[model samples]
Target: MDAGPFFHGTKADLKVGDLLIPGFRSNYRPEVVMNHIYFTAVLDGAGLAAEIIPGDGPPRVYEVEPTGEWENDPNVTDKKFPGNPTRSYRSAAPLRIVAERDDWTRLTPEALAEWRTRLARMRDENAEIIN
Candidate 1:
């Protein structure tokens, strides 16, 4: 899988807790991060939080001191989801970010079926297209 984007340098202004989604209810670390993106729509901490100076396109890997304890909570790990792996603190890593456009055609079968049904009903009703 492609790492989305890479940022480096000491973002002292940014807090680890800042990467955390507020009112996070997941026991999994990755899920927590995904929930942060799915609900809050942010991708700052999907991977490891590191301290390095960013280069032109990708970032230069640098040794970063651990800011806090990396906990391996089973309550958050050892689970399975449909598409993505279960989130774990161990899965955290710092990597270069890659940019790509979202392909909406990759949606789940159930979601596609629902959309098809909705569209068919709309077509039958001759609903005016609203944008």
Candidate 2:
């Protein structure tokens, strides 16, 4: 599942040499501080994640490299899908940004709306985040 030229998506205006580290609040469960930085091999999947996170501008996808050991993102690995179909992983170490990618597809308005609704419902239901 780690067959990646990995990518991370976010709204942060980071440069090619920037590093993404862990120890931040979980985007899904804000009350939990994340110990791992997440990434995926699927570009558009990162784009979708970027869209979910708040930012000053449109979401951006970045080519990245994990600086240390990583593992299947427990949040999705068997908890949601049967395996790592998304090719998502997380690391306690830093991820170095290699370049910015602009080719990922953006979600349509309807799709975005549906996502927002789903997120709200998850919040209402007290959905759990593995990390």
Candidate 3:
């Protein structure tokens, strides 16, 4: 069963033993894994039993359509595109979910260092330069 807006990026082939979490939001915390399929059994009240696309098959592509509500959100950050806001931002891109094993593993040191450097650069660029 489709879980609606909350399950926007959810896949259809996800099984009962899979893990899920609120990816980009703050209200959702502590990743939850699925433990049951149907509601006939005792519910753990933890993760949801979503139907995500299995990792053994091709990735599913979802076309994103704008709902014309982003402008109403106060947290929306306006970005300058090509020096022209009118002729710049056109449409939203599709959100894709590739099937993969949901295992907990630490990133390699080299990769972590690279990410740290990238983050440092971003922080430097956004830092307030005081006289």
Candidate 4:
């Protein structure tokens, strides 16, 4: 498998209680993040607030430092969802999202199916940073 994006720097320390707030430019919904096959990474200087990608099974959260540099991720185009427009960016040094596994038995069967389908797509797009 592909090693994934390369990012060098100090790693940020995180705790379980830390919250991953969504930026104005971000669509922080768990379902959407997984379905869209978004990637998150851990980088030095990343803020205390992290971004989260929630799958039906579990949620993955990433911590990344804010940088002045920004580039368009070729994997995704500008998304126009009704009144909301979601933009995607790529970093030369992408951070990784680390999350714990938990049982989300409350999800409907349809939702579970969708999550699996999206996860497959995510794998195909290499949207995740595999260490």
TM-scores of the models, in the given order? Answer: 0.22, 0.95, 0.22, 0.31
Q: Give lDDT tens digits, candidate 4, residues 18-93.
A: 4323221222222333211223232211111121223232332343332324444444333323321223345433
TM-score of 4: 0.31
Steric collisions counted per model: 7, 0, 6, 7
Across 1-131, the per-residue lDDT of candidate 2 in tens digits comes to 46688999998889988999999887777778998999999999999999877547879999999898999999898889998888999999999999999999999989988887888888789998877
lDDT of 1 by residue, 1-131 (tens): 32223222222233332342223332222123222211101123221221122213321222122233333323333433343343223223232222221211233557546655664565567553211
Model 1 stretches astray by more than 4 angstroms: 1-100, 103-105
Q: Which ten residues in a row have the lowest lDDT in candidate 1?
A: 33-42
Report residue 35 deviation for candidate 1 (angstroms): 38
Whole-model lDDT per candidate: 0.28, 0.90, 0.26, 0.32
Q: Which structure among the candidates has the greatest TM-score?
A: 2
Superposed on all Cα atoms, the candidates' RMSDs to the truth, in angstroms, are 15.1, 1.1, 15.3, 13.0
Among residues 3 or more apart in sequence or in different chains, the pairs in candidate 1 whose N, CA or C atoms overlap within 3 Å are: 4-98, 5-97, 6-97, 9-52, 27-76, 30-87, 48-93
Ranking by TM-score: 2, 4, 3, 1
Alpha carbon lDDT at 34, candidate 2: 91
Question: What overall lDDT, based on C-alpha atoms, would model 4 receive against the true structure?
Answer: 0.32
What is the RMSD of candidate 4?
13.0
Best of the candidates, lDDT = 2
